[model samples]
Target chain A: MARKALIENDALIDRLSATFREVGYEGASLALLSEATGLKKASLYHRFPGGKEQMGLEVLQEAGRWLGNHVLKPLAGEGTPRERIAAMTSELDSFYQGGRQACLLNLLSSPIGEESPFKATIRQMFEAFVEALASVIAEAGCTPAVARDRAEHGVALIQGSLVLARGLGTTKPFRKTLDVLADELLADLEARA
Target chain B: MARKALIENDALIDRLSATFREVGYEGASLALLSEATGLKKASLYHRFPGGKEQMGLEVLQEAGRWLGNHVLKPLAGEGTPRERIAAMTSELDSFYQGGRQACLLNLLSSPIGEESPFKATIRQMFEAFVEALASVIAEAGCTPAVARDRAEHGVALIQGSLVLARGLGTTKPFRKTLDVLADELLADLEARA
Candidate 1:
């Protein structure tokens, strides 16, 4: 799977992200990483001097930042809360390839994900995701507790659908879940209005 | 990690299950499988002629049947739908260890899981799970379509909560998702009654 094209740093991170998202932390051996990114083992070691541990941390950080910029920030942006939610869903949809893919966070958090030294980083990614969703709901005028609960619930559904959709061999479950999520997101704001 | 105790066939499967649940398909090398199952690589090959592929298919089937008997059969068993859903939830909670553990299907279906020959087996597992839940819901008096939708939604929430709960390092979200699922499962029946 190695490409002959010149690979930039960001491209390397993206390649690493794709590999990690598919095979997970422990499964992403140097051989697979080399194949995925078209980098030699020495090249990877040079790029990530700390080796797999550093590579994992960097990839997790990169995915987290991508979500923050592409998904969360838009939800917490200044448009109407409903509009913001819509934008956020689109961001998530694109990031996940409309449920055709697993979340990098979930992929990374597999058994190796749990055992990795980067566990805290994974936890932080989820907390930030939850917080971002909560902020939007709170702005929509629900009590803080209610808003937080909704955010947690929404995240859980989205995560579960990926498992189900993939398990069931259909994206319909995921697409339907998104529709339900859209409805759930605006329920409070519409109620208050 | 090979244990010295006499390992029953079921015990060996459980050990293999735990390893698969932890390291995933590609990550679970013969050496690791040997360590997990207390079998020499030659012994494992003798037991499973198809090697890792056979081992994976066997493990996935074992897990699927466990879910059918413990989770779905109870849900579709003789009882009120509420009672049935309750039974299913209890089985799921025990299986997941209150969100402290990840699902084997989820663990397996990482990139390698999809690429593995067991993909259809995984799909069948979900289809059966969905059907089992839908039967209980429909018997409670909803139309088949509505019951199916509710079952799908309920499964998605439960599945999503596992991801969220594991990611956030807490079981509260998973526990709460169960509550919501209970409500959703009976909502139509309760409304009609």
Candidate 2:
């Protein structure tokens, strides 16, 4: 019985993440979450008694961890700068396309006209992303300050590309923008070389 | 009487554009818009018989024109490349801060879950932005391809900065990012020099 409950908890988290990615926090109501998870409202309440806020926080933290391990870590690994950047860009494209989702940070941060408990968590996630990327760029031969700037630029590119992709209603531009940004960053490194 | 009606129509467009900038298209309902404009729903409907979609399209078009004239035109004007870039960056910061809003293109493009007329208009607005920025970069002594790339980068910076600002709940970083981007773009041009 305990094992079954764990499995159900995992399922609920996955479903809640997907729904939040699609509709944002305020937009995702208990009714919608219940329908998406194939669980009744009462059952969802049983798992997340704090309700949608609790679910949203869990989903965001999970996403942050996953993105850190999958996207940022690999890029910060030991590799030639060019290879590392290519890997990072490829990973981003795959994650976005495979998930068929926009950036969770952007969705969560949008001015939905209310204060969300998730905002601070989302901001911290981005700060971590910038720090991780900065470390990688510094390894690639940029000065610490330059690496920080490059990392900020890269984050801006990805975040903006997601907005563009969402606006264009297609992922092609998003993928293309990432590719372009990767090339630009690598070229800047080469010039320093 | 006709002149008075024309003035009222213009005011409605301005109010609607302001409202859209504050809240995204999906979140900005007719009720909110009516409240923002201090006009009843009946007056709003009288002005925009086709309802939110029609009003949204007009707001988008008006905002697009404002961006082109106020933001893009000055940057593309005759000045030293460094001067022109600085001017453009300052203009963008002021425009965004003055409105206390995110880019309308981004707001319109974000999903309310799929196919909608606003999508096409947003795409058109982006293309216009790209073209205008490209022209300026081209004028600043870059190859056409490089100019296009720079233009796209500029758009990405602006859009991403807004997201960052919203996430952090402050406009300072947004303004700072644009300043950094302008400096980067100028540095690239100087390297070529």
Candidate 3:
């Protein structure tokens, strides 16, 4: 039964994540969430007693898990810096689904009226991303400061490319960004090569 | 009478823009907008017969106007490329209120469900930004393709740094981005020099 529940929760999270990604945190109304998930309000409430906040938090946690497994893990994996980053690049392209998906980090980071309850979670995710990238950059023989700066700049390029991709209504910028990313991150390494 | 109406309209747009920037399109409720603007719903409806969509559009249009006057125009102004970019950089810092303010272009670009009515306006704003910046890069003696690429990369850095700043709850990244911007934009020129 516990196993059954785990599977069920995963399914629920998938549905909820889809809704949030489409409309953003504020856009995901209870009515819309219910319609999308095919779960009555009560059922959703029974599962997520804290209502939309809980749902959003759970969805965010799931994204964090994915990031940990797919993004952070690979960056820390056994491959060289180039191999790891290239792997990360592929995962990012898939994770964002070729720039067709909106980033939950951007969408749910800020909500109207009050501070977002997810700020810490969002911060942790981005921090982890930077740290992971910085590690690889450090491994590539850049100074710690250079590693940190490059990591931050890399994340900025990614987040900014998503915004640019969506604003321009094309994926060309995103693809172009990905193409240059590995080289950009390894510039210090290649400078000595 | 016309003058009075124009003044009132600008005031209304300011209030509405503030509200939208905070909550986003989906988060901005009639009640919240009414409360923020200190106007009754009926009065708001009276001013914006097309309702929330119209209000959002007007706010976006006002932002576009500000960009043209403050950002694009300065970039195209007579000066060395570095001087013009430096001037434009100051405007950007002020416009975004030293990274404390969220960008309307990022905020209003994507709406939940049924496409943003403001996409065209948002696109034009970014396009103008790129075009203006690209022109400066070209003037700095880079090829047109290189100019366009750098302009896009520069924008991605700006947009991404804003996201980074907000996520990290510090304006350091944003400020750092500004510091490096002039050099990055004119790297080609500096290389030849």
Candidate 4:
């Protein structure tokens, strides 16, 4: 009989996810995971029976779920498109900690993760996020192609600004880009209509 | 007597840099470094006497030099501003491998590297790149303030597009962003003049 997960709760996943996001997957060893979660190695193993790989997969899924709930879903939520976009941007600002946070997707989507079992999940989240944003843009006025392109562009802007914020050690670039891009997308649409 | 340095060759540094870029600092353990560079642990320690931390600092410096020499220097080279910007953009495209390759700076600027002794070097590289880019834009016709803002914006665009390209599992977004941003920054100046 297989042992079941009793303690791989949301809090456990959050703790592990922070470790993975702060370092990359390869860096988060069993010892480090234990240190991070205040759990013994055996306890962590009991929670994540498959070890580091399983922990990574669960963390990746959690990140995707968070994005779905906080960003993608909000973008697709009902409101004036402008209001929806504004709310989504606010979620992004908070999610990224005003650009001081490193993006887990960027961290996990690298060559180190080329063979990760969860790699496809990262790509799917990105596509879904883009699709949600593009839906709002297309509904506003842009052709489907243009809206899709803009949505992808917006994703890059968010991820890259996080990189810049971390690099330049300033929240200004990330904050400004978010506000600027949001206005360009929503305000421009309002003007066009 | 302290042993004089005999190893720590540039080629070894290059190999380690690639590993770091792929998996990030915390991910590139001494064992992994040995695997990536085909060097024995003793040999790597002999080369980098201070161990992984020493190797990391050297790699960070090398990345800065490469950016300065290739990207920033080209942007400030002698030519019409438009010509100079075009050449720099081409260099950026190649350096990033059509956005397929991960950025070493982004890899190092993560939370994992927050305590890295070389963090300031990363900031310096970004500032230098922005200054080089701003100089060209200012020469083209924009006010100094406008040029600087645009240069920062361009940097964010480049970095963000890389994140997007990697996430979307395609180069089209990266390439399109490069072309579109380049046109906005460069070609428009000529049209206005």
Best-to-worst lDDT order? 3, 1, 4, 2
Worst ten in a row by lDDT for model 3 chain B: B1-10
Tell me the spans in candidate 1 whose CA falls farther than 4 Å from its real position: A1-5, A110-114, A186-189, B1-5, B110-114
Model 3 steric clash pairs: none
Cα error, residue B33 of model 1, in Å, equals: 3.3
> Which CAPRI tier for candidate 1?
medium
* Ranked candidates, highest TM-score first: 3, 1, 4, 2
What does DockQ come to for candidate 4? 0.56
The window of 10 residues in a row where model 1 chain B has the poorest summed lDDT is: B107-116
Most accurate candidate by lDDT = 3
Pairs of residues at least 3 apart in sequence or in different chains that clash in candidate 2: none
Q: Write the per-residue lDDT of candidate 4 for residues B1-193, one digit (tens) a residue.
A: 3864343467788889888877778777889999888888997887779988889889988888888788877787787777787788788888778877778788777572466676788888888888888888888887888887778778888888888777777888888887777665664475454
lDDT of each prediction vs. the true structure?
A: 0.81, 0.74, 0.84, 0.80
True-contact fraction in model 1 equals: 0.73
Query: How much is the lDDT of residue B172 in candidate 2?
Result: 54
- Model 4 CA lDDT for position A145: 94
Native-to-model Cα distance after best TM-score fit, residue A116 in candidate 1, in Å: 1.3
- Cα deviation at A122, candidate 4, in Å, is 0.3
Higher-ranked by TM-score: 3 or 4: 3
Error of 1 at A184 (Å): 2.0
What is the C-alpha lDDT profile of model 2 across B1-193, one tens digit per residue? Answer: 4434533667889889878777666678889998988888887888889999889899988887787887677776777667777777788777777225777786666463567778778877777777777776676677888877677767777788778777766665576677676665554565554
lDDT by residue (tens digit), candidate 2, A59-118: 888888788887778877867777777777788877777225777787767563456687
lDDT of 1 by residue, B48-134 (tens): 899988888888989987987998789867777888888888888888787877777787774533565877787788888888888
- Which stretches in model 3 have alpha-carbon errors above 4 Å? A1-7, A111-114, A190-193, B2-7, B111-114, B190-193
Report DockQ per prediction, comma-separated: 0.56, 0.40, 0.53, 0.56
